[model samples]
Target: MHDPATHHKPRIAISACLTGHSVRYNGGHKASDLCRTQLEEHFEWTPVCPEVAIGLGVPRDPIRLVGNPDHPEVVGTRNPGMDLTGPLRTYGEQMANELDDICGYIFMQKSPSCGLERVKVYQDNGHPAFHSGRGAYAQAFCERRPDLPVEEEGRLHDPVLRENFISRVYAYADWQRVLAEGLNRGALVNFHSRYKYLLMANNPQAYRTLGRMLGTLSKDDDPLVVGPQYFSELMQALRRCASRGTHSNVLQHLSGYFKDALTPSDKSELQELIGQYQQGVVPLVVPLTLLKHHLRNHPDPYLQQQAYLQPHPESLGLRNAV
Candidate 1:
């Protein structure tokens, strides 16, 4: 969703491990230059390491979950059950609050302290579950900002998952923009409108849900509903599903909308690029690059207004890539 030409950008929180920070328990870094080279030009990143912040020393014995999956907490098993519950929970709370502009989180994979998915859960008998429940710190972070996009680095390698992550990040940023102005159904509609095509691209169900929400609009009504929170939960659910897919399904879905927007010649040219991407001869961004270029001159104001596809100029590295 790079739209750097429009001067739109977002701020995000990412684990230090993903940024190549030596904040891991192993004293090594797993920096993602995908972020360093591509996204660095657009987003301002806030780095965090819950394990280190809780007084865990570098190269220390690793930690794991040790209770009910829902309520299980983190601890250093070899250190006679040193609990990191309090500090991690508190820090997550503060991090959530302090992150004024944060729209998403990119965490390290399989980290007992930071992994968002597939973390090894230990049983009472001290056996591994070989799956993730969630990390204590990451769980708290999600709890605090359920509307924010959260993805583990490993899952992001999946194109569908990656698209979903990107969609949610931009959508959350859109929500932030709406909140900054004032909460209204009009703002909500506007927010959904921008993301309409993007959702249609990834998840048809999500697109329809949003369409129904938009249908609820009433001129004299207050767009925001107070507690019992129907509207509130709706927003949360949308953000949660923003990332989920295989690129093939999503790309096929999205291409439908763009078919008529392109001329026969334009479609042919774009198809060639897409063929290259599908065959892995070119990266996924190549077709998106062309689609974005043509979208600028698209006759349909409605399509152009779907800002979610091209959320910010830097989304596709359009402005900064050159």
Candidate 2:
């Protein structure tokens, strides 16, 4: 069980409909299974339905954007007149300000009021003019805080995006914890140490880069000159390490997780699977499946102790899944 009081919690903003609440444009919900898993395991959610929050009642007629996007108005189809621009924009600003600690956001799909991208923008005569517009609240939210990681539920279907989301969310969450607790040199060293293996599995280039970076933080290291830009520089480098890079690194690293214990037959099978992946005949998951199955027999206490490999998702694929 996760003890919220003892552990550092990430305050995440999620669309209310994704939590199985009926806050959709048509008074329905589109809860996601993976999202629910994350909700239960991690995250302290601050649910918001912008349209509902801005005084648009549940079961109300749906609204769509019309005219110039720079000055679009929300008009209800049934009424032909429900201007919610002022209230919606105002509420968005309020939420953005009040929810200062929200490290990330998960939005619903393709909604004019909540979708993060590609929403329909209608013309003055209610004809569809364009299919590239963002939600009112989402635009406002991003405008207010451009640094935060934001993802729409539809996009999370991609494995690479999902991996990136998970990694970035955890990184942001951990950084906030470090900020709150005030990391000392000793703690920072240990923190970096704990992530060493995980970094290797996720992204070796980044892992090696981080190791090299840490070497500069010695006792004689001058943070006064670099302190202002240290963390930003570190993360920016990490951001360059692609999902493909990490997935490839992870496959190679997991090979070490079972290097010593596999039987001759198992070794041959693993070898064959890897050969297939290398030859572009098989997906990376083939070898990973064998590893996960092999893990059942030769359980490493230390491997299980690590949080990164725990609860491994079979659903995710590397470049193929992406």
Candidate 3:
């Protein structure tokens, strides 16, 4: 009975340049139409430019990661002595605490200050190294909140990664809401119940392992201890993009709920659609929509509450791509 129209949009942190702010080293924005326009309808954004926040001027000299890839230093390309490594790391730590309320972050790709991965590191001779390193600011920020969902703008163009990221964002937002309401054994069980099929689709082994952890809890157990472990495992499981085979497995399992209600033709049609989806003839939304329609007619309370049925806002059309 939940209406997404009334649901609060999850708050997100994004690179300021992606929001059309001219905060890049060249003094121009790397504006993302997908984030600034399409996704804006579903998420509240907190634009952050770590470079600018660290007191770098617009149109400033570009910086590069140098020396060891594992512990590279952020220094100006034109002047090696102009190191901003400490400042960027400091700002990242500060923002990680400041933006605690945000459920997710979208970083600018290939940015020396914001790229999530595969950023170039330079040698003493100014040649790019064989191995790449993450942005100093991004490395520090993620270290502070490893469980928080994050993706780069470039990676978002991949439909599967995009869907997975959005799904994780909403799931994290749900966990945030649960924390706000205060945690207990019953609340934890209920949260896990809703994500049952979702977790299974993403990681079958993790789903069983997490369920057993909760199943073993007693009334005397502390939510403070159990909650963090459960949430951490849950987020990690969701990080994996569910394969078509896994999704089809979940769909088959879901169909079992209506076995007694569906007519022979209805069952046949549903099975056909699922097969097509599994074989990649159609997107996941096709089978998912049909299942939803049948559920509407049959009305099973347990099945109705599953988050897998509607992971993110349907308006986002995320399932259509996957």
Candidate 4:
């Protein structure tokens, strides 16, 4: 495994077409400017065109999913006899193993072989049966690495989803570093501590649940046994995007650390900003920027270690929207 924590740029696997490669069936690209420019600056990209990798040439016949949505078959749209489901599935599995080190993946939306969700599966009569199918290769790849962060390029346009996806990718990279350094009870505990506020904002129940789970660990207990379980739960918790209410709660908690350092007037200002954030009067960045400034002056050791303060690069400006 390529240990992403040791690498300067966290590795990301992306759909080739999204990167402006002429890999689509029509010999054109879906090119996402965000992926091609913005994200490309911070992360290393590994483009994969499963269709092309499966020996399907550019400008090849378009394919569609058919039969049971849960186990759809990828077949040519014009001629159903041309099936590529088996090859695509095999290739996905192979790549999953090869790209085990990648911190995340960005799939092309609505693709019969890359769409992450809601792909249309047609009936035998050429009518759309349901829109619940997953792309053949995507389904296989996701099953192989359910813990990995993944999002369709289209979904990244939504600020909240984009922020969540990027945060999870960085967190996943951090976890990979822990694994590379060797997992132990101490390392696991420290990792959870660093993400305390982050987990609370996203899923408060998970924060408590995971805390108790770790608190129960004895020196005799094995991290190898608990590491996978803990990570699975943590990732699942992150999938639920934090609401404004949750964010307000977390902001208030962070504000408490500055209670003594802040005078009555400064405290009142901070509270008003948090209240405004809850009421949707301002974006999260406004209050967060203030909180960070206070932390810089007051400088609490624990507060400084919290990943919530800087979940992703400030240059991304993800918090400005939500």
Name the top TM-score candidate: 3
Location of the lowest summed lDDT over 10 successive residues in candidate 3: 1-10
Off by over 4 Å in 4: 1-7
Judged by TM-score relative to the true structure, which candidate is superior, 2 or 3? Answer: 3
**Count: clashes, candidate 2:** 0
Q: Please, what is the TM-score per model? A: 0.76, 0.66, 0.98, 0.96
lDDT for each of the candidates? Answer: 0.67, 0.66, 0.92, 0.91
For all the candidates, what are their Cα RMSDs to the real structure?
A: 4.8, 5.7, 1.0, 2.7
- Put down candidate 2 lDDT per residue, 44-126, tens digits, no spaces: 78888888887777788988877776656667877757787667777767888988887788898777777787778789676
The best-first sequence of candidates by TM-score reads 3, 4, 1, 2
Q: Kindly provide the TM-score of model 3 when superposed on the true structure, using C-alpha atoms.
A: 0.98
Candidate of highest lDDT: 3
lDDT of 1 at 267: 78
lDDT of 4 by residue, 1-322 (tens): 1122344778999999988999999999999999877788889899999999999988999999999999999999888899999999999999999997899999999899999998999999989985579999999999999999999999999999999999899999889989999999889998898888899999999999999999999888899999989999999899889999999999999999998899999999999999999999999999999998998889888888788888877777889999
Which rank order by lDDT, best down to worst? 3, 4, 1, 2
lDDT per residue, candidate 3, 91-180, as tens digits? 999999999789999999898889899999999988999999999999999999999999999999999999999999988988898899
lDDT of 4 at 115: 96
- The regions of model 2 sitting more than 4 angstroms off are 1-11, 37-43, 68-73, 78-81, 100-103, 184-246, 249-322
2 or 3: which has the higher lDDT? 3
